[model samples]
Target: MNERITPASDPSTWGRALDEAVNILSRGGLVVVPTDTVYGIAADAFTPPAVQALLDAKGRGRQMPPPVLIASVQTLDGLATGVPAGARALAEAFWPGGLTLIVRAHPSLAWDLGETHGTVALRVPDHETALALLARTGPLAVSSANTTGSPAAVTAQDAYDQLGDSVALYLDAGEAPGQVSSSIVDATGETLRLVRAGAISLERLNEVTPVEGPTA
Candidate 1:
């Protein structure tokens, strides 16, 4: 059975919530959580067993690598190596919000982050409760909280209705703030390019990246 957690920016019971979330994560349990954009199901990034469980819960294949969420941009260096200037620029621009940056994995930390060949997608969510949870749990492997090919969850009820007994915890911080997912860009090469476009506009992305490339 999963527990329903009401999230708050300045949570009166944040300490308790954090304790529960951390314990669940450390024990490799799946957690359905809210982000600045959409609701995501998270597990410990370092645990392959937990990752496979998350993929099974979402009905997603290995091809759809889950993005990792960390407490702060400072933690990026610990996961990925030589983050490019453009990548850093965007993180500075839209971090602690809805933007996923793909970067090369550090050789030493490579085994834990899973199969990206050599790259990993990372984000720092803009929600206070989410960040607070991440700060304690370290990096978590997260993806939209829904079955593969289904409409992503935008509320705690949406998550519960779909994920039901699959997850260990359902953090219902009300509805997803943006009602959409983060715009993703692969910064693995010389140029930053779009992998998925949702909330953040391409016009806005151009402001950060050079305006010359095919829009995927």
Candidate 2:
């Protein structure tokens, strides 16, 4: 069953909550966590059992792979390859924040990360708790903490309401900032392409990188 931890804003409670979350993760358990955008159910990226548990909890199909969250842009180097110059620029400009990137995965992955036909989706979340957890666990495979085809949860209660006892831990950092999920960009090329649109505007992306239209 899922248990709701106190708000992470409280320094003392926050430390306990973070420690418990990390312990659960290290033991291959799933945690419903807060991110800059929405609540997501996360598992250790390198653990096959953890990945499977996350997928099973979501009742997700293997055809659609989950996205991985990295602690920083530097973490991307080890898990993925061919991170194009434009992608790096975007990461520098908007990382440690919203923005999921689809790039080629490193050849030597321990678990089945996803089926992007060789590509992987990665993001660096912009939350202290998220970053702290990532730093401790390395990287995490995370997706919105809701049943497939359901509206994303923006509050801990929403997550608890929908996910119920499916998750191991619930990190309630109060309500989310309410920003939509990051706009996805495929920058594995000289130009950036908008795969999905959200809080990060296309114009803003253009200001920093060449937000090119998709190529056939």
Candidate 3:
């Protein structure tokens, strides 16, 4: 259970920190990273063992799989399929913020995300440190950096306290914004469905494209 913590707050340290984080992801390791909404535990999306380790660290089984974080909004098509026009509109408007789009997984992808039911949830985070890591690591399977039913980690220390040595490294970029988690939408079907409401409101979402909630 060996672990390392790297401070990524300083601009000068970003180069070194990102390099180390990239290396860790390359070899199937988990890292606690600061995101716009909260800190998340990340692993290489294409590495089955690493993804499994992430799920294990969070105490969630295959039924609750982690979402994939991408470097850019354009990366969505490469990983997911059957993305409707409405989903694209939403991605264009709220991406790099806190919107998670759940679309059908690309048929050609070789990786296994566990009981995904052919769907993959994807987002492009707004935080600089998280984006820098994603730019180098491509897509990472990431989830809230806390155990099941626990408060989401808002800092690297919060994550380390719960995850302990299960993670290979913790990228400390100071406290996360800690406002709200990303809003999720299910776009695999004909109509867009609101899976979870968080930072982005349903009203704001409908401004871009119509969305259905429980009431709908």
Candidate 4:
């Protein structure tokens, strides 16, 4: 099928664009969407095949699983088990912004995001268009909108150029607000470890709760 690019910011097309994105995701298709940090390729989180397809599109492997994006902080407990006190404080302080937390997944959930090793990375993007899409589709398994070794996309066209027909649709709401990705913290253990440094600094994260550097 041919790729479809929708102008998500157009008042005349906003509703239609969202509906089409929701339809595409419902069918387990891929979509390139704008977020506060950068563009991302999104798929239904619960669909294993769809998640695998997204990994394939980026030439990524099962070792590096995609993060799940939720519309709100309330959804965290629904997806993750044993979320730490620091993690909850961090979420309350900086959620709906650029911070990703890695915690143990609820064992009963039936979804394969590939080699998560019982842990799932979750984020709540601070972009209206992304939030709108998440509101309709629930949690989405999303990765940066770029092929392996390429820079993450800042605009829909950039994502399209890299992803092409691999993505079913591109939600173009213009450039993403930030070029940096979200800072990732692993909260499953006794200490919160900063996994990947990005938009939020370690100092800033510590202001809310103690965050240590990556494990040796």
Question: If the candidates were sorted by their lDDT against the true structure, best first, what order would they fall in?
Answer: 4, 3, 1, 2
lDDT of 3 by residue, 160-203 (tens): 99999999889988888845799999998889999899889899
TM-score of each: 0.92, 0.92, 0.96, 0.96
**Which model scores highest in TM-score?**
4
Can you list the residue pairs that collide in candidate 3? none
What's the CA error at residue 102 for candidate 3, in Å? 0.2
Give the range of the ten consecutive residues with the poorest summed lDDT in model 2: 1-10
Lowest summed lDDT over 10 consecutive residues: which window, candidate 3? 1-10
Q: Rate the local accuracy (lDDT) of all candidates.
A: 0.83, 0.82, 0.90, 0.93
Q: Give the alpha carbon lDDT tens digit for every residue of 38-141 in model 2.
A: 88899988888888888887778777788999998988889889888888888899998888898988888877855667778899999877887788888899
TM-score, cand. 3 vs. native: 0.96
Ranking by TM-score: 4, 3, 1, 2
RMSD to the true structure for each prediction, in A, is 2.0, 2.1, 1.9, 1.7
Clashes of each: 0, 0, 0, 0
lDDT of 1 by residue, 101-196 (tens): 889888787344345788899999998878888878889999999998899999877887888887888787778889888988888877888778
Tell me which residue pairs clash in candidate 1. Answer: none
